[model samples]
Target chain A: MATNIVWHEASVSKEDRREKNDHGSFCLWFTGLSGSGKSTLANALAKYLFEANVQTYVLDGDNVRHGLNKDLGFTDEDRKENIRRIGEVSKLFVDGGQIVVTAFISPFREDRQQVRDILNENEFFEIYVNCSLDECEKRDPKGLYKKARNNEIKHFTGIDSPYEAPVNPELVVNTESQSIQESVKTIVQFLEEKGLIKSGISNGI
Target chain B: MATNIVWHEASVSKEDRREKNDHGSFCLWFTGLSGSGKSTLANALAKYLFEANVQTYVLDGDNVRHGLNKDLGFTDEDRKENIRRIGEVSKLFVDGGQIVVTAFISPFREDRQQVRDILNENEFFEIYVNCSLDECEKRDPKGLYKKARNNEIKHFTGIDSPYEAPVNPELVVNTESQSIQESVKTIVQFLEEKGLIKSGISNGI
Candidate 1:
């Protein structure tokens, strides 16, 4: 009877997937306060990589919660669960040999560390989209800061909730000072330097 | 200083990988008692898929513990961690659009549920490799039954620990009477039915 169990397994090996993609895939975790341009940067990075024929996907805070993690809430436990699911999803992309760019407030260090531990050591790259509370508030493109000030939003990372900056992120982008084009250029250059993109892959014009 | 922080990003897209692979990928979670032919069936399944030009990988119990899951143990917490990591890895494969086959003595319903919860509902396929303890002992392919009988292997499932059979598995393969070839054919048929694989794909003959 032991011979009767039929299991449908993976069709491709991990190495083959990586090779077919023509570049190593890893998690690009972006952490910052809301309106710090994390999602903007992540989107642009994904577009640039895609144009260059790189396999890429973006997991922004808003997009993921809308679908894959819609059941979660804003409470501490829910936030942790939210990040946990994202970490698992990101790990999936990395394993498939695709670059994954995730942007979230991700205020807690322990949660970020949990994500790192889930993936391989070198596969996780934390990018702190560093912008001061004042700067982020000024650029409150979503008016989230105003809502939080009016008590319309509770546990806002930079307000009632705390935003613990990464002690040592892979890249620190000051979104307040850099132009969007410049920021994308910097990120694209970083990806090229990391050999995620081919050498001399031009940033969008 | 920046070089110290590695940026891990994939240079490929999910659609690109899927187009190249010519099939969508998913995770096949196989649960059963040791010596029940989970690994035997998983290996044969992977081999068959590989030959058929489907990208595949198998995370067998012994192989995973020896590498990806080395830090874990038999304790409940460790077991949770073990299943959790496997879930993460499996998700990675699915994202890369490659089918992943995992075989473990994942004894508890709760643990298996946790894994399923981590994965998408449609992406997770639970295959129960059903073999009676009496049959498993008779097979004793790894001499594990002998070890357990001698008290050399403590906390062994179906001996010291409980082995909760899946109540409603997606597929039940009775290893007692079916031949290995029959088992592989059944699994492949399931995949084809699910539209995961094209019919008549030469799975490595």
Candidate 2:
């Protein structure tokens, strides 16, 4: 305990990075069903934030599954472990002074809570991307829903598996009802209001 | 495959982040025996980089073992997994456009090579913090050497286990001979010469 206090008092690496970057660093965790348009919205927001000069990065299945979590499978145990590692990586990004957007169908309340418990207050913002299962299945961006229907994939959230939504998320966006541009604007506005980022977004955007 | 190209051509998130942060991002991998001043020198270099307005963070056993790689142990296989996870996390930081300094014993050549292979060209810099085992045992910063000597710790690098030094490290600093300030300056100068960072360090420093 004493050592931790001395270390924090002596070496404020997070504070130094935030000051240098001229912004607050935190995780914008987007959770929902598999086909809930999480990747599209998260990438769009990342691009928008980059245009506004906010240091940002996105951690989706594309970058993660093939490398860090390749050994993990779709079993219940592996699902929890996957979310756990992603949460830990998000914390590192937060400490590095960048806004990290993680688009994962983190389907367990306890698992999500574990991540929230690990981060400092105001560092973990749960953004629940809401889309009805019917809608998501209808869209089926990656065709995983069809495979799940054919039993080609097991433990699929909203089909064979369960998706436990956030009990009290910081923000909830229903992508089915809103245009992508409007959804992106709403998130940017929320970030601006929270003072997590400065307002440099051009009016034309 | 086409999607990745389309995404890259459409959006350059990393380039955007680097421009905003005003510096290139990469990993400074510090490998050495325990108590060899790896942590001390990495932290000192981080402090120097932070003063120069370079986004920087150090991932050492203190911050990492308790969080990201908490499940990993000192066994040979776990050690490999530990380094692999750290390498992946470092890649995320680079994508986030921040210089991440990792200080670990990381004794195996193949393990270090795996990290280098995962990163893009110019994105990984292996820094060998060379210290004689005799000097390291004498300093014994954390009393780990005493425990290792008494057989309280097993598979300890430079003791019961072997430490494979880097054959073609980008840089090597002998903490036993050079002052901490001098070592930090040497690193800063190297970064400047490599165009990874600009020479903004004032003469007063």
Candidate 3:
């Protein structure tokens, strides 16, 4: 190597990216029961944010469970570790100045709290996708509820296991009472009002 | 709640992001001994890419070890798990339509090959930052080499642990023979020739 060779002074900072992206960055953590429309809401909102020129990505079981957390099983310990890794990954996306929307059952309050502890006060906004168990079971989007009822899926959340609902979430969208677009619009308006995202593109709420 | 709203046809695809960012999305995986300038080169190239309006992010020990892989230790199993998680995260970035630059002393060929298998053929590019052990030890950028020599660090690559060099790397920059600028220029030109990054900005070699 040349004697004069030196390290660059800095890498691009999160603020630099936020400025370039023209929006603040944070995590929109959507937790809900199976068939509660968490993934649908998360993806819909991500698409809306992308259209509005906000750097956004969705982290859901479809992308995460089979990839990053494949080694983890459905055991209690594995579930906790799964949430921890996902939280850390979400933090990285936020660090890159992109809004990361994650959809996971995340049944435990402790697991959700751990993720919150890792981020700043305003960086993690938990949005509870509220739905009655009867409604979720009726929808059974993935047939998970049927499997759980059949004793095929042991310790399934909101069935064999318990779901500790968020006592004080940043927002709550009752999926049973509203359409997906309505849920997306409510969240977008909330984010815009909170100054988490810039007000430019009309979300057509 | 409105009843007419429906799921969008698609979220942003990798192709859409590639066209939007005007650059190819892939992982530039840098592997070498400690103090071999992997982080420096990765960040410098990332800075260049960002300046060219390419969506780019770098995953290094500074950002990852203390957070995503904080629970992992120096054990062989832990190291393998660490690399696995990093590879999976890189795949997510590529899926999101951004070039991800990763700097780690990933010492196992099998681990590196696993990451390659997870990604498409062109998505994973292994760049060996070749530097002589003598030169790296002399640099001692983080004093890690000194600690390893003093037996203060266990399983330190190129000292107590082995570093399996790439059998068929996409590129190898001899850091012992060139400056950082030259290395960055070499990589930028190589990427341009391969159409990994669009040819627009003239990188001054």
lDDT of model 3 at position A68? 97
lDDT of 1 by residue, A1-205 (tens): 1232234443445566577666788899999988888888887777666666566777875557755566578888989888887887676567656788998889999999999988886689998898889988988999899999999999888899988999999888888888666777787788779876676664343
User: Candidate 2 at A133: error in angstroms?
Assistant: 1.4
Per-prediction DockQ: 0.11, 0.24, 0.34
Estimated TM-score for each candidate: 0.67, 0.92, 0.94
Please tell me which model should have the higher lDDT, number 2 or number 3.
3
Model 1: runs farther than 4 Å from truth?
A1-16, A47-53, A57-96, A108-122, A138-144, A151-155, A166-168, A177-185, A200-205, B1-21, B39-96, B106-124, B138-157, B160-186
Q: Which one wins on TM-score?
A: 3
lDDT by residue (B1-205, candidate 2, tens digit) is 1112111112446777788878999999999998788888888777766665678889999889999899988788999999999998888888778899999999999999999999999999999999999999999988989999999998788999999999999999988898777777788778888988876452323
- Model 3 lDDT per residue over A1-205, tens place: 1223233535888888888887888998999898999988888788766666678899999999999999999999999999999999999999888899999999899999999999987999999999999999999988989999999999999999999999999999999999988888889889889988776343455
TM-score of 2: 0.92
Instruction: Tell me the deviation in Å of residue A142 in model 2.
Output: 0.8
User: lDDT (0-100) at residue A175 of candidate 1?
Assistant: 86
Evaluated on CA atoms against the true complex, candidate 1 attains a DockQ of: 0.11
True-vs-predicted CA distance for residue B118, candidate 1, Å: 8.8
Error of 1 at A197 (Å): 3.3
Model 1 chain A is weakest, by summed lDDT over 10 consecutive residues, at A1-10
Candidate 2 residue-wise lDDT, A90-144, digit = tens = 8988887888899999989999999999999999999999999999999998899
- Candidate 2 DockQ, CA atoms: 0.24
